[model samples]
Target chain A: MNLKELYQEIILEHGKNPRNLRKTEDFNKDAKGNNPLCGDNVHVYLKLNGQKIVEDISFEGSGCAISMASASIMTDLIKGKNEHEAKEIVEDFLGMIKENPELMSENLDEDEKTKLMSLSGVKQYPMRVKCATLSWHTLISAFDENKEEVKTEN
Target chain B: MNINQIKKEFPIFDEKIQNNDLVYLDSANSSQKPKVVVDRINEFYTKQFSNVGRSVHYLAVAATNLYENTRTSVQKYINAKDKNEIVFTKGATEALNLVANTLGQSYLQEGDEVLITELEHHSNYVPWHFLRKSKNIKINFAEINEEGEITLEEIEKKITPKTRLISITHLSNVTGAILPVKEITQLAHSKGIIVVVDGCQGAPHLKLDMQELDCDFYAISCHKMYGPTGLGVLYGKKKWLEELPPYQGGGGMINEVKKDRISYGELPNKYEAGTMATAQVIAFDQSIKFLESIGIENVMKHEADLVEYGQELLQKNNSVKLIGNPKNKGGVLSFVIEGVHPHDIATILDEDGVAIRAGHHCCQILHDKLNIPASARASVGIYNTKEDLDQLNESINNCKKIFNL
Candidate 1:
């Protein structure tokens, strides 16, 4: 409902020039997600080391500002964390976008929480909550090695 | 009738949409129902609600007559050769599926080709795709020119000796390109190809004449024509409708059933099985009358003028790129901002109570051909005005400001 809150300065900047928007070299896991309603799509790639620590995370897709910026900021914060930390952050972000007021994961620092909170404006726009969560869900699919494509219909 | 006066007939305009006057520009998605059509539904339910074509009760007989009257009205409206040619289905999707399924059962052979264009909606293409999977029929696409039009020549070039049917849209919902349906139908008929039209976008905006266009089958969405939902009209040549197998089998569509064999009812009833959308079908007669009262020619002119004005306004605005520039266009105005995604633009515009569509508009093939994920579209109806387009432009500016464009 509030345009200023929805399209914040940081969101706009990240959407225009998305970060880590490329296929990670030697990625071990990847998954594709699509919003069939709007035709927005995302392909999440992850490169995890032998120790199961995240070495690289990136995405390749086109979408609305909320989606692109969410994916860009997600990859930026999730690159160095281990698999457990990355999954916890994903759950916390999805929770906040769904209903919770704030992030609830101990794995994420205050700066990381603040960066993710900018996308909380999507909660008011129920049709767009899928836009903010598609990449996160796809990243989870990548981690689990689920080959089925994720479809965000709700 | 004046556009302002026409707008008053739709009661939704009187109510504030989020504290702003509703600038509804999504008619291509579905049109707003007039007071007459809405009140007809209420009146039918309140006073004369009865299941049609059933018992010998007074209301059932009256309701049956009323239902058949609407069928006659549709026949006259589309200028079909026989009233039996017009069959009511659940929706345009169901109508098109009925054609594809019946033809696949009786007429189409394995390895035969069904030609469709890039401008077809998923409803037009997906049903034929079922034939591809089950019957192994080949589906060919007629390419679109740079102007986003599916020309008659494109149809000609795609036709082979194996081509058995050609299905296409009467108007592109995304590009606003009005396909040359009449000429294409003529060409397809010359080559003995069946032409089925997805008239969801065309029925509401263009003047329809089945006898003149001479297409073998045309599917119309009633909701898009200011009628109620859950009802659609399919106009097929009587011979084809009689010859093709029945789509759905139920109580109404049956002539008789035995352990050994079953007989189906006649033309229209065979297509319409079970209980129909009784209230919606009865109410749709008023929608046809509403169009007749205003006259389709005037409606066409008003929408054409609005699209022209909207096109010029957006073309003058910086960073706004209108989608297609076909010589013959409809009421659609699709565009993309250089630095803004269509979803962002649509959300920002919705805040100003400018309701437009932002998506593939069910034409993913056309969007893929255009090489963009999605685009925003603002389509007009009989009630839309130049001031509505002006409000749309102002909202687009607000979106640009929010995106820092």
Candidate 2:
């Protein structure tokens, strides 16, 4: 209910001054995603060194604090992980948003779960779920190297 | 005028939103349906659901009678000279597009010009925009004044010998500025130019007498006037409707299909291509009756009072910037507050169980003209009360304070 606390200093800092907020020109994989309903756009870049992702992600976009912060944290979480682990993390994050807390708690610890709980607040506002998960969905779309186009309407 | 009595007619007013009474100020987007309209629709499906004008059965005859009864009701509602002149369309958007595609193709040529105002909605603007592009015709916009009012002088400047048609909104969706349609139509007619009036907003609030205004065509949406969605009325002059070709080619629109050639149906049916929304059309009669019972003049007066009250309340707050002219405005009040986006304002208002519209309002051209990305609008309807306006003002003030504007 406290939107100010929900968009805390950490979230605001990540939103205003996000880390890894750059387009990778020489990257092997990239995908552009947009929440057309709210005019949010994210360009995700992935650097895959064989099966192991040397640097899985970064993104540049304009959106609300939740979307930007979620993108920022998601990039940090999957940076040095393998493609399978990254996919699992993505699925787990999506399950959390879709309100499968058990699935979310299975993957993340208590402190990390509290941080992800900020996104759970978006469930109260059904209209804003897309704003919170736009970048995460974009990251999921980027996992497929051969499939260039991925558009989901949730 | 009797708030409690009028409130009883609408079932949604009785429903609570977030433990509070719903103050629906988004009527300009879509008005809430009255029980009469709802009951009529329910009755149609429950008793007499059948395809109209197709069979010799009793149900078909009854359905056909009800469907044509709506056309007559629309004719009387708008004061059209002939009932047959009115054609049922999906909505005003489709109605406007039908004119642009059918009449624009027949009348407009490569060097011809179409004069439109800057305040037109996307439905009114884009159809002509597409026509201009496809036919290589010129599309010119008349300038809007500082108060967002389009003047006769500005329209006169835009019109030329090459101007084949002049189209404009009867009342601006954003500004609520009532254009002088009579003068505009007379001027267009003087120049041998046809006129098309987008009456989607105007038809809902005002008594439209097509004989008096004498425009070549006028388009209206039923949903905006408390009627069901997917049913609209397009009132065209008989000569113009006859001259313009049918917009879409389909089954019911044709009278005879030969091996190599086909003959189209008569006036109204020629334009009506596919299976119409029969229940909605029947329900449209009840909406028209509902408006007729209360009377449009009284409704307009009530709405004007609300608009004036809203203007006074909104202007008292320094942070809130009213968008349109204060004087001679319709029921719509579009505004923007400092330091808060219209989208954020809408979200906060929604939390308080107050619904208002935010965005371009399907008038991207007007937004671009005003040099604003978006605006928030609260439009009045028959069901709305002064308390609703007060709640809206209070919520907007709350939004300003919350955003520290």
Candidate 3:
């Protein structure tokens, strides 16, 4: 109920001075994603060194605090992970937000659970879940293009 | 006039949201249904549910009578010349598109012009845009004055010898400014240009007579006028309807189909293709009756009173900026607080059980012209009361406090 707690200093700082906010111009794979409902758009670029993501960078164009912060944190999390590990991270993030099945098991580590719990506020607002995950899904599609794999249902 | 008595007719007023009474103020987008309309649909399914005008069975005959009676009701509702001029469409969007596609294609030449205003909704804008692209016709726009009212001078300036048609909104959904349709139609007619009026907002608030207004075509949506969704009325003059070709080709709209050619049906049926929205059409009759029983003059007076009350209340705060200043406006009032974004203001209002619309309102071009990202709109209807306006004023004041503006 407290908006001060909802929009904490960490979220504001990440939103204001986002990390990895640059275009990968020479990157092999890139894709543009947009949430048509809210008009949030993000262009994700992936520099993959033979399936291991060497440099994962993104630049976002959005209107809200939560969406920009989510994009910042997602780009920071998957900067150096390989494609397989990045896919698992996306699945974990999707589970935390959309209540997907993988994270329902009670086997998460303390730090991983804490990191996922940062997005727990999104569960209360269904309309905002897409805003929080737009950048992450775009990154998934970028990696899919790099690996020459067709995307499944979003 | 009694809030409690009127509240009893709408079931949503009794429903609780977040353990609080629901205050719906999005009637400009779509009005909530009264019990009469809801029960009309219920009765049709329970007793007389059947497709109309086809079967010889008893239910079909009864359904045909009910459906044809609705046509008569609508003909009288808008004071059209004949029932044949009324064609049931999906909604005003489709109705406007029906006119634009058929008439715009048949009459408009490569160098001709279609004159519209900047205040048109996308439904009125995009169809003409498509026509311009396909037919190589030029689209001209009349400018709005500082008061958000379109002037006769502007319309005259925009019209030329090549201008073939003039389509405009009867009332602006954003600023609630009522355009002078009768004068504009007369001017357009004198210039030998046909006129089409988007009556989605006006039909719900004002009294309309197609003959008196003398507009060649008028598009109306049922949902905005307390009827069901998926049904709208397009009132065109019989001469124009007879001249224009069929909009869509399908089963009911045609009389016969041969190897290469086909014969079309009668006046209204020629334009209405496929199986119509029967149940919603029947329920639309009840919505018409509901409005008729209250009388449109009373509805207009009550809404005008709310508009004046809202203007007096909200404009007291220095932070609130009212959008338009027409001498004759509708019940809609769009405004923006000084520092807070419209979306944030809407969010805070929603937490306090106050509903409003906050966006470009499908008028992106108008927003671009006004150079504002968006504005918050509070529109009124017959079901609304002074208490609703008070809630809106209080909630907007709370938004100012929250933003420390």
Candidate 4:
């Protein structure tokens, strides 16, 4: 119920100047996602090595503080993880954001888990859950080489 | 009219939204219902519910008469020439689709152009776009000026020899631009072009006179007019309604149904196919009565004053930018904060129990032209006051403060 829970300091900071907020040149994987309700859109780009380890990840989009910060933190932490570990972390994050009290992925370190937990505030606002999860869904789409644009409503 | 007394007629203000008074500024999207309108729906369902125009039984006759009474009320309210000119539709979107579909079937031809404005909502553009795919008609857009107003000159410029129709909004939902519809209609008529006015925003705020405007077809959204959802009125010219083909083929709209051949019914019945929104159509009479209680002149004045006050408040705030500067505007006040997104603005404002719409307001072309993804909007209705605008300004200040702007 508190506005403070939704718009924390770290969110405002990262939303103001998001990390890796650019197009990754020579990117092997990319996908677009948008929340048609509010015109929020994210284009997530990833460069994966031969072993399917993520070497770099970046995003380009405009949205609310929750979305920008969520995308910022996601691209920051997803840089070094392989495809399987990253997908597990995404599943863990989605689970934590839905009903789980804590993130359950061992692939994430204590510090990485702490950063992702800040987005748990979106769970209280059901309408805002899409803003937080848009890029993560787009990341999955990118890995699968799905050409369809990610829609939160779908 | 006393605003506080008039506000009390709506029971929603009595309820608390998150322990705060509901400051509703989303009337452009849909207005809150008055108690009489709500009670009328309850009364109809409880006592007078029946399928209209079919059975000769007591309840059916009474229900049909009540349904017909709303049609008369709408005819008088909008000052239409004939009551049959007003066809009940599901919503303004459906009304528009009916016009486009029926007109496409009968009047328009392949390669004919239908001129519209960039200020149109998706409802106005998308339906016509369907014709483009099917009939191969080209859709031309009358560009908005720097102030966002669609001038008569601009419409005149867009009308080529092949232009057969011109569909425009009476008022832009986002920019608050009131198009020069009457003049444009006159010009289009002279050029042998049909004019359809998307009057969704116009019917509730502006004066509705089909005789005066003289547009061929005008769409009205009842829910935006403080009436129930699932009901709208399509005010078409008698000639157009008669000449155009039926939008949908179903029970009541048919004059005769044989195995091989069939004939459609006359005027309004031809359009009112299938079982209609009986309860909503009946209850919308109360909405008309409610609006009549407070005159349209009074409604316009009060809303204009609120928009002016809100505009000044937002303009004075640092880093807050108003979207359009139309000289003649509506109650809509859309703006963007330098560092804050509209969704962020809406969420922060809601914390103070101030409700507003954030998005393109369903005008993506305008937003794409404005080069912003979305903007926050605060639109006023009859229940809204200067105090509500003050609250909106204060909430914007709080949102800015939170964003460290």
Candidate 5:
């Protein structure tokens, strides 16, 4: 309900020019996700090295400002982390968005947590929480190598 | 009665929607119910509850008479020749499916073509698609013009000698372009092609006269007419209803059942197989009376004015692009902002209790043709006022300011 909190200046900037919004050239893991109700879709691509460190991560999709910003911030934070750390960060972010007061991931710095917490406004609008979380769930699907596309519910 | 006074009839306006007075602009999705219609449902269930079309008890026969009385009311409302021509279904979706399934069973043959417009809702398109997969039937789509209208010319261009049926919406839900159903039905009948209308949008606002239109079949959504949910009316010609097979087989639709052979019942009971939505059907008579009280012509005029005012308001706003410019439009006003996504706009608007719809509106074919993922829509009803459109315009400005447009 709070428009200023939901459409923060950083979120709008990220939505306007989302980071790494392209197909990874040598992606090893990938998965698709969609919000069938709103026609928003995303494809997460990851390039993992031999030691399972995140080498490169990118995505391709079209959606509203909240979704695009969520995906952009996610891809920015997820790069260079190992598989275990990446999954933990995903869980912490999802937990914070759902009910927890703050990000609990040991891997994320204070600045990174603040950037993700900017999306906490979505908690008030239950219908829009899915828009912010769809791309994060799709990233997990990519890491797990799940073949089925990820679909979000309210 | 004054059209503006109609808002007082619906009690929802008196309550605050999230601390904001309800400025309902989503009536095209489903209209707000009048008190009479709502009270009728409660009265029926409270004191006069009984299963209709069965049993010899007093309440049963009384309920049966009440149910049949609604059928007669609908027949007179739509100007149909016979009362049995109007059959009750679960919804407009089921009505369209019944037509497609029954035609697929007896009338349609393999390799035959069914013509539909790009403006059809999923309910109209998906039923015919089932026939395509199972019977090798061909489904053809008539393209819309730049104004987002499926003109008579466009429909004519798509018709073929093998086209057995033409199913289309009486009004485009997204574009609000009212199709020339009567003229199109005339053309289709001349070529021996059946015409089935998806009147979900049309039934609420338009003047429905099945006899004058002469279409093979028409489907109506009662919820959109300020009636209760779980009820719809299908107006098929008596001849077609007699010829087509039953859609769902159950207790009521059978005349005689045996181990080896079973015979179907008469026209309406043949289609209404199981226990129907009796209370909703009975309450729907109040909805018809509601419309009759205001008169369709007055409703049409009021809505037309509202749309015109809404169109003008949005057109003057910068960065707001109205979707269609059809000369013959109804209550729908679909648009997109250059920078703001429709979902974002809708969220911002909802904060002010200005209810509108955002997405494909179940006409993905039209949206795909328009080459956009989705657009926002604001549709008017009898209770909507010019001030509602003004509030909508002010909200759009707020959304643009938030998006830094």
Candidate 6:
């Protein structure tokens, strides 16, 4: 309900200069996601090493401040985690965005949790919930190696 | 005309939205209904509700009279030659689909071309696309000029020898460029091609005269004309409507329901199959009365002033780029701000209760041609005023500040 809370300083900064906003050099898995409502789109690239660790995570897309900031912080926090731990973080973030009060993932540190929680303001704006979760859903599709494109209609 | 007094007739402005005053400017999507129209819908449902054109009972006859009255009013308002030429549909989408579906069934042959424009909404284009798949009809698009207008020259150039029909939008929903429908129709008729117009945006703003324009079919969205939803009117020439096959086959649209052979009913009913939106059709009569009270010329002038004022304000603002600098424009004001997405702009504006639509505005083809993902649009109606545009510009400044632009 509050615009100030929705467009926080950190979100504005991260949205302006999104981190890891590039395609992975040797991406093994990639998936495209589109928010057909606003025409926002994202393509997530994943580079998993031999030990099932996410050696690199990057994304390329154009969207609103909330969506760009969500993807930037997601890539920054999920870069070093293994595939299993990364999937857990994605579930935790998705649940928190929907109804959960806070993220409940042991894999994420306090700082990482706080960074992701800034996007929770979108929960109040139900029409915008898809913007915050499009990239995360695309990341999951990339992990599963799903060939179909991810489409968010919420 | 006193725009403020006209705004008071709409009851939604009396209430606050999210604790902020409602500055509705999304009329291109759907307009706010006046109190008279809403009250008529309630009165019809509460007291005189009955299925029309079915029974000879008291309420049935009265309800049927009311529904037919709307057809008469619409026929007179649009200057159609006959009352039977006006057929109601679910929406303009369905109306246009009816034209395409029937024409594809009876008229268009394989490899025949139907020319459309880049400024068309999906409703206008997608129907012809069906003909492409089913009947192998070719669809050609007339490109827009730099001002975002589908000029008569473009239409003339796009027409080939095999072009059987040319369907286009009366006004671009995203660019607000009002096409020269009359001239285009004349040019197409000269070449023996039929013309269909998607007037969803135009019906609410421009002066409509079916005889003057002389197009084959014109589709109108009643909700955008300050009427109820689930209602649209397709104004077709009597010759075409009689020649084309029935779109839907069901109750009321039939003459004799036999096992082997079934004959369709008369002109209007032939297109309207099954139980129609009777309540909406009745309430739409009041909508035409509301517009008549104000006069279309006055309404046109007032909205023209608002668009001019809003355009000048947005043009002066830094970092704001207005789309489509067409000399002849309608009530739409589509623009984009650099370093900010349209969804972000719309959200920030909604905080101030400045209602505007953000997205491709259902014109993705136009967006792709313009080379942008999406743009924000603030369209005006009879109820909006200069003060609302002022509030909109102020909200844009606030959004810019929030983004530290």
Q: Say which prediction, candidate 2 or candidate 4, comes out ahead on DockQ.
A: 4
Per-candidate TM equals: 0.99, 0.86, 0.87, 0.99, 0.99, 0.99
Index of the highest-DockQ prediction: 4
CAPRI class of candidate 6 = high
Rank by lDDT, highest first: 6, 5, 4, 1, 2, 3
Please tell me how candidate 3 rates in CAPRI terms. incorrect
Model 2 stretches with alpha carbons more than 4 Å out: A1-35, A39-92, A102-116, A135-152, B400-405
For candidate 4, write residues A30-107 as lDDT tens digits: 999998887899999999999999999999999989999999999998999999999999999888888999998999
Consecutive 10-residue window with the lowest summed lDDT within model 6 chain A: A2-11
TM-score of chain A of 3: 0.79
Instruction: Report DockQ per prediction, comma-separated.
Output: 0.88, 0.18, 0.18, 0.89, 0.82, 0.88
The per-candidate count of clashes, in order, stands at 0, 0, 0, 0, 0, 0
Better of 2 and 5 by TM-score: 5
* Residue B104 in candidate 3, Cα distance off native in Å: 3.6
Looking at model 4, residue B191 earns an lDDT score of 93
Interface RMSD of each: 0.8, 3.6, 3.5, 0.7, 0.8, 0.8
Chain A TM-score for each of the predictions:
0.98, 0.84, 0.79, 0.97, 0.98, 0.98
- What's the TM-score of chain B for every model shown? 0.99, 0.98, 0.98, 0.99, 0.99, 0.99
The list of candidate 3 runs beyond 4 A from truth reads A1-31, A42-60, A72-89, A100-118, A139-154, B317-320, B337-341, B397-405
- lDDT per residue for candidate 1 within A1-154, as digits (tens), equals 7877888888999999999999998999999999999999999999999989999999999999999999999999999999999998999888888989999999888998888899988888998889999999999999999999999875
Clashing pairs in 4: none
Tens-digit per-residue lDDT, B227-289, candidate 5: 999999999999999999999999899999999999999988999988999999999999999
Output the worst ten-in-a-row residue range by lDDT, candidate 1 chain B. B1-10
Query: Which regions in candidate 5 have their CA more than 4 angstroms from the true location?
Result: none
Q: Write the per-residue lDDT of candidate 2 for residues B325-404, one digit (tens) a residue.
A: 82567889999876565766777787678999977798877887888767889999988888998999888877666555
